[model samples]
Target: MQPWETRLEEFIAQQYGLSFDTLTKAIGKGPRAASKLAQRLKKTGRAEVARVDCGSPGPWRNSANFDDPGEVPHGPLWIFSERPIAWGYLEFDPGEWRPKASTTAHLTAVTELRLALTGLDTDPRVWTSERLLRRRLKSETGRVEVHIHDAWVRDFTDADKVWAVEVELSRKFGEGRLARALSAALDAADRSELAGVLYFVRGAGLRRAVEVAATRLAHQRDVDHLPNLEIHDLDITLAQKGMRS
Candidate 1:
């Protein structure tokens, strides 16, 4: 396979599937070109459209729980082959993978960030899915049952630092869960297991909440006034692909 084609497959297999726009962005191809490539891969036994195989709103969509039938939770998904490519730091078994009906937004958002960061001219960031972080945290730190964040990142120029990126579309933490979750992830930061923890929130309320949580945690841990946590607007970057105030 060509280098770009290999990248396309890698992106698709990373999440077991990806939207056409994501594939296009990741492979640096136009939509039409990406369409052609998807077709070629389909014909070549590498991929198949989910709608065709599973039927619309079939098992894959998991839309039965929604009250509004017109609301399409996610774009048409393109399912790929079960063949594993052994993505660096990421662990995925395509054959046994089943994407939850609710996580489509989160999953796609992650790939968008991956594409945007990959396009950076300098110090490009490498995004690893939560799967890899989970395995690595357990194996390296012997910390099991920890709440893994959305994604982990490593900049090309900085090999020593591994950062955690959390995308919060809605309120993810409760009063108690907030402290516990941040505590677990921040513990990694304290031990130098994670260089930084970044929370990308959808709106002001969510952003403020995350910020407050970080502050409280810092006070509790007696964190050296130099905090390693930061909260940012998700849409502030190209990854969100929308307007922000």
Candidate 2:
């Protein structure tokens, strides 16, 4: 495999899927080049192509069922600028697992964040993926279950300290799942699991939900147990860093 081909696999390994445009931007190639690269990966059985939005975020990606399954179309993604896209048809890793179409942007968001911090470099102490964190936290928790954030980040200004990152795309309270999770997270922070926690929320509703959840959890536990919890609007946060939202 060529160096770029290896990089392509690395990207898929870290991010569940990404648009051809995203690949274009990351690899300094054009859409057509991205298309060819996708085909190459697909030929090697390492990737597959499909849209994320049947027109939802960019077009319905996989809302298609097997019976009349819509085409897993292939084409170049839209790239009007250097900014990476958060949604669109994608060339994705093939496996038993598939992320939901609606959350494809969520995966993109996380990918963009990683790119901003460390590009394609692998350094767990600097940026640990949630995939890896799952094992680490599971073993650390033992019987004391704790909420796992999306990823862990080394503070940009202070490399020695690490913080957990949560990308909140929607409200989890309505599903009856966030409160206990939030409380458990607070407990983990109290136990000094990491330096702190950061939440990047997709909307005002999510921002409010997180605020309320943190407040209630803080009260239930000690307010000091909040562990430097910080929340920011996802788009604005990314914009501040000149990254794609």
Candidate 3:
């Protein structure tokens, strides 16, 4: 791979997804540079690129109006790439477009990943969303599947910290899913698969709730414990960093 192509691939793989503008700024490329690079990557079999439009529209939206899906359809300019590039169609209905929490969570993850790489001087060799979802573990609690929204590794002074990051924009974690995630984190901690589990919540109430729930669960467990876990309000972090506007 060429130098610029390697940089682009590393950025995309670390951030999971990035918009056209972010790509341009990161690589110091012109407006059309990312598009041309992406096209070349796709044509040369070096990478796969796709545009995604997210969120559920209002009730008036109809699925039939959506363009037929086969290859990744042309949509908003938000570009996503995966390592080994998972190729397929991403379909969405046209409706009253509004930002969704899931979509924002992903963007927030990308931001955090960038912060870690730059501020912590960590390598950009982290797992993306697709790779994180593909990881699973077997424990005495049964088969624990990892659904970590995002994860990455950071280099500390002495040790490398593997962090499993969870961006919670809403308090809508179902009981089963929350339980499974808790189990998986505990398993990862116990087996030294991860260095820590971090939760970035949108509100103080949600942060407190997560802390209480995790504390209660920890009290009930004897064999496995979560010692390297942290919950922070996402809004506060953004404000502190002047990232909120």
Candidate 4:
């Protein structure tokens, strides 16, 4: 395993509540790279390596519960659902879990603000439901889930204007995965409802990869199908702006 890859694997295993084996599999690397990745992660001090149980079923398939429709109750604001949405429940370190709440809140606020600014009726109630935002994307390997936030304004005196937003925050994943996610979001949108795609990145080096992917995806579309793609660096300034007025 490459040093960075090992570091990433260890970091994810500790930070994201993923098992070492699971991390290795998700990372798709051999033993040497995986070992190196784990070692590198140890050096970062952002994560720790331990012999953890692989656990039962994967969180994506098992812990997610969607059968019961519920309203958004006030709390940490991890998710705000207008309606009940499916999600997985997994064990995570309380320390590492802190960022999850803030990240979700920031994204929710951005979605709402963008919609309002575009003159679309803003509904915080609907923001919690993943079902309304998530769609399946076709890929050579399989379908991947991509969440989309779309807004538009209709003028009584003029033609309607529209915009589409796509946000991705990935860790230890490759550009190919991000590309698949973006492609899925675009494919799911109605051409008439889309104005552009905003791609957000959180990991190192992945931003450049996403840029390339966005370019390639842009080429695949016709003049009308092509949505404006903009990449933003994830930083504290942007996060604070999204969170506070």
Name the candidate that leads on TM-score.
Answer: 1
Error of 2 at 195 (Å): 0.6
Each model's TM-score, in the order given?
0.72, 0.70, 0.58, 0.37
For model 3, how does the per-residue alpha-carbon lDDT over 35-90 read when each residue is reduced to its tens digit?
77666666777554444445333222222222343434323344555334422211
Off by over 4 Å in 3: 1-4, 14-16, 21-25, 28-50, 55-75, 81-112, 115-149, 173-180, 222-226, 238-244
lDDT of 3 at 31: 59
TM-score ranking from best to worst?
1, 2, 3, 4
TM-score of 4: 0.37
| Each prediction's number of clashing residue pairs | 0, 10, 0, 16
lDDT of each residue in 1-245, candidate 1, tens digit only: 79656655665665556665566666666766766777777777766644322224533343322224654433344445445443331343334454444666677676676566553221224666665556555755566556677777784578888788777787765556766776776666556477878777777887787777777777777874336777778777753443112
Clashing residue pairs found in predicted model 3: none
lDDT score at residue 48, model 1, on the 0-100 scale: 62
Residue 140 shift from truth in candidate 2, angstroms: 10
- Model 2 scores a TM of 0.70
For candidate 1, the clash count comes to: 0
RMSD of each: 6.4, 7.7, 8.7, 17.9
- Model 4, range 47-157, lDDT digits (tens) per residue? 444322233222322111211244222232111111111111112122222224334434443443333333122232222112223222324564433444432223323
lDDT of 1 at 226: 32
Candidate 1 backbone collisions, by pair: none
Worst 10 residues of 3 by lDDT: 87-96
